[model samples]
Target: MPEEFRTTRRAFVGALAATTALVSSPFVRTAAANETFKIGILTDLTGSFSDLGGPGTGVAAEIAMQEIGGQVLGRKVELLIADHQHKANVGLALAREWIERRDLKAFVDVMNSGIAIGVNKLVGDYKRLAFYSAAATDKISEDACNEYGIHWNTDTYAQTNAVAASMIGQGLDSWFFIVADYEFGHAMQASMDQAVKKAGGKVVGAVRHPLQTLDFSSYVLQAQASGAKVIAIASGGNDTVNTIKQAQEFGVTRRGQKVVALLPYLSDIHAVGLKTMQGLRFIDAWYWGMDDKSKEFADRFYARFKKRPTAVQASVYSSTLQYLKAVEKLGTDDPGKIRQYFLNTTLNDAFLRNGRLLPNGRMTHDVYLVEVKTPEESKGEWDYEKVIATVPADKAFRPLSESACKLRA
Candidate 1:
């Protein structure tokens, strides 16, 4: 074995042993030979999305395990994680190995949209459960719905539709866009266009940046010349942060125009900081400061990690907890049984409550509109998003009837 793989295996085994020891004690339940529940966390641990998807998700799963007393029913849950490297092929390969060889009960948290879509198909073919919390493409649940997968959190359609419709109605009618070049980027752009048109706005022009383009000056320059009242960016995680910061530096906002990031979160805001991230608006699924439920969750997360949980982290925790719950209830690790249980049941977890699992594999949860707070007005670190609107679960996502899902049909 390669050195890194060997090290990763050793660490994974170590973690497994530690957790098992705790769970097998008097406080928690022990795993039955017939009921060892395994879950795989595939994420960009060393790539673009890692800033939001890395330590946060790993720790979040641990938090869920601890809260559940490290057990469920009469079984123990074991988590296995792999680094997807932001590559679709790598994600698919790892997913296949985990399902076929490692006996993973489910695959969760494939972060990049392209990778998420790729793994979604594999999950369907193998009849293994895939719970997606990080990928944002609506097509994962819409066009590509599967009996074995559930989209657990926000999608491109929800994020763009909510922000674009509101901004257009607010007199930000003319729009210019900087989009990443991929399925996710295209879906976001398309959703934004639909929303803008619905609200009587027009897209002046748009530019597409390559997937790995770090310098966004050229893209911002094109948007600057479009003369649109609002410059919109269709990207997320690090891409979103870099583009927003570059737009500010290039004075894209000073040219009688404002910049709007379609997706903003605690991780990106922390990276960009309040000074440069202020006055920008975006859509979010969960903000730690929003409500009593959210506050309680955030407090516990910070107590353990010394950092507030990002929406992605919270999504990981909820999805992990929900899957484990399903595994216990079904009394089997058969993928189809676990999947059916997940869809037919209501999920009331830490990050989401009364959230429904739609037939198209979409998990309908509350989404919010938020603006970044200015540095001087900020109270502390992670005080990034101030909720502007609360979109109810039903209104927050695309309807199932509109989804061209083969499974639903």
Candidate 2:
């Protein structure tokens, strides 16, 4: 070969060899392994439900991510948060985008039930995991549950059943409902109604109000006119706060009708003073001061958000941490494997104690029937709940035999 041709051929051969080696090397696998694992939080950041599980949920998830060292399987874990604005279509859009474009491994803290149900369907279709920390509708676990979704916090069925049954057992038999005219409110009212009936109580009257209604006087009047012993508020967030405040204004409690908030958050109590919220009974999945672990978590959370963590926010932390741990243990974020691991394992964490994941996608844990403390009884700013009774996990949630989920069926 000519000298110049020989040199050129040698250069070409060297370049080709380098390219072939690069293609066969572990760098490709390493790149794949190091790809970022992302978890998205689709929640209401600035809507009626914001105070309960909005930005606080993001903080909780971040706390969990940091607790897990912020990495998994040699991959950097990233969190993507978006406000669904309390709209199901908006939530679905954000969730679909995150799952498809960002390769989101999972979702946590989908706050509103309408939005949660929509996101649950999208997550199921994409075979991704969703840990619902705040969504209260029972349909997510009962009729709309997927193998990839888990209701990590309290649901309407659990809250209403526990609270209503407890009150009914105490001789407060007649009930009246002031419900928010939405999916969540409807579910809550329905569940409470069923619970009351099953507990040998009667629903004397029921009234529905629109979301974010500033006035609840009419509803309170209707409830009072019904002559029921217990007037239950089957709503949440700002609506719950407003209803309670208006009901108190209407002297509903003073008139001897007990006002019960079916789904009230710590923030709700804070929004409505302890005096107004005093003597109010409800069911909660977790309380900040429940144990040392919870207090520690709450302290850290309060440090960040300037508020104690609600049960929903705590569940966000718990579920997010557990999901990250499972990914670490399995060495992958495969939804099926993670689902099996979660279903087979009992979750005991700062937020959930002796929690078990049912086939219907409910994470069953003990729920507390708590009453708001009188202003004098409250020692400090977030010391509100006084646990009157503990409802066991098995009895707190709907039984699998009655589950509408095909997986359980």
Candidate 3:
């Protein structure tokens, strides 16, 4: 095993042990502050996704409050954020502790699918809402569905299917996958593998890397040797960034191969820079430069974050704004009321347009096929993506008929 992989694996095991110890200890739940209506954001704060989500998500929540005139249900809305560090138990513990101790009405920004589901039962038991802005697990809306869990953005299946269909149509048939060895990565790889075969393409080769891997040199070598026409990266956050950068350095793309990222985000592009990430095509639910609404939202977000907002950050802003609006109109922060309100009404916002909160907890919307612009094509720093095609909302997500959600089709 490579040194980076060994290091990351050790850290992963250590984190698990530490998280188990932390959750086992009995700590008194803090008294709830009745003066503030709080929403806790549980995400991978200090881990690989921190640069992709952390400060931006917190800022997005604040921006959502400002959009709501800084008050909801006649109380000052408070944003409580914790870095679960991508540990499942840590996320679950925070989900329970945030509600029981802090009296947060809802939880937002759960960024890992495994952790998202781990916290699902806690959110349901506590009767607190969870809007998954970045987590990409499909089972959150399927087998692991929770009444209080609201999947607010694109999931693994949608992105994988969208990219697979588009690429296969263009005749980029044979593929090699570089994936993170975990739930989110596995799901993405599985989705892409299935989609490729179904679309008459082939997954010729694949490899898995540990989370927060420092180097993807070996993975890139394996992908290159596979002679696959397309090297599909089924990872995100820092892992995705490193893989693409290393692949470029190794001339993987220059050698007549395309690198298709299954989970590319604005933050990842920004981290990699347009100069290096040019011509990369990705499928996502939002883009900051796509329209007037997106530009307006992006400009404000850029002012606060000093960087372009990722789709995850955009979802945080939209979902929180919608949640506040629900509380403002209903005169309560009740989860049942909020869930019904979201399900029954349509939410068209600066980020998510014409989306409905589905019975299976999916926030359904159109998925866009976007490409990273070349540095010469970019008019400005954050002018990263150019929209190419759109997958219709009705056709974007999984059909309700196939879902196990209690809410009938």
User: For candidate 1, lDDT tens digit of each residue in 131-209?
Assistant: 8888888888887777877898898889988787777778889999898888788888988888888878999998888
**Candidate 3, residue 164: lDDT:** 85
How does residue 76 of candidate 2 score in lDDT? 75
User: Per-residue CA lDDT of candidate 3, range 1-409, in tens?
Assistant: 0011111211332332344334222222112356778886776545678777765687787788888887776777766666676777666776676677667788767878788888787777777888888888787887788778899899988998878888889989999999999889988888889999999999898999998899899999999999999999988898999999999999998899999889988888888999888888888799988899988998898776567788899999998999999999999888888899998998898888779888888889888989889999999777889999988888898889877677636
Q: Which residues of candidate 3, in runs, are more than 4 Å off?
A: 1-32, 404-408
Alpha-carbon RMSD, each predicted model: 5.3, 12.5, 7.0
Model 3 poorest ten-residue lDDT run: 1-10
Q: Write down the lDDT of every candidate, Cα atoms only.
A: 0.76, 0.81, 0.80
lDDT of 3: 0.80
lDDT of 2 by residue, 1-409 (tens): 0011111211322332243222211110012322778787776665677778876787788788889887899887776666655666666876776677668789976877888888888888899999998888999998888888899998988888777777888999999999988888989988988999999999888999988788888888899899999998888899999888888788887788898888899999999989888887888888999889999999998877778988889999999999999999998889999888888998888988889988889899888888889999999898999988888899888999988899995
Could you give me the TM-score of model 1 versus the true structure? 0.89
Candidate 3's displacement at residue 236, Å, is 0.6
